[model samples]
Target: MSNLNFTSGQTIPNSVIAPVSADGKVCFYVYGKTHLLADVSGYFPK
Candidate 1:
């Protein structure tokens, strides 16, 4: 497993989404315990 080494109060840029699911749920793979924030910008009609 790999880790995302980020500093406190740091902002990470965009990430890519692949193998999307029908339920519109996403999963993040982290190596250890950390805090996460996900913001949805828009939506697609089903």
Candidate 2:
């Protein structure tokens, strides 16, 4: 995994792949006037 750094007033589209919990939940912590959107492209079986 990699980290993304953004400046103020930056508007770019990015894609990331991360793992979710067993209950299919992901956690995010955002700071200061940010908007987030997520989509699940696919899932893997346990």
TM-scores, all models, native as reference:
0.42, 0.69
Q: Runs in model 2 with CA error above 4 Å? A: none
lDDT assessment of candidate 1: 0.60
Please give the RMSD to the true structure for each candidate, in Å.
4.1, 2.0
lDDT of each: 0.60, 0.76
Any runs in candidate 1 off by more than 4 Å, and if so which?
A: 1-19
- Give the number of the best model, judged by lDDT: 2
Q: What are the per-residue Cα lDDT tens digits for candidate 2 across 1-46?
A: 3446688999878777778887989877677788888788877777
Q: Report the C-alpha displacement of residue 21, candidate 1, in angstroms.
A: 0.5
How many collisions between residues are there in candidate 2? Answer: 0
| Candidate 1: worst-modelled 10 consecutive residues by lDDT | 11-20
Pairs with backbone N, CA or C atoms under 3 Å apart (clashes), candidate 2:
none
Predicted structure 2, TM vs. truth: 0.69
* Predicted candidate 1 versus true structure: per-residue lDDT over 2-45, tens digit per residue: 33567667777655434447786667675555667666666656
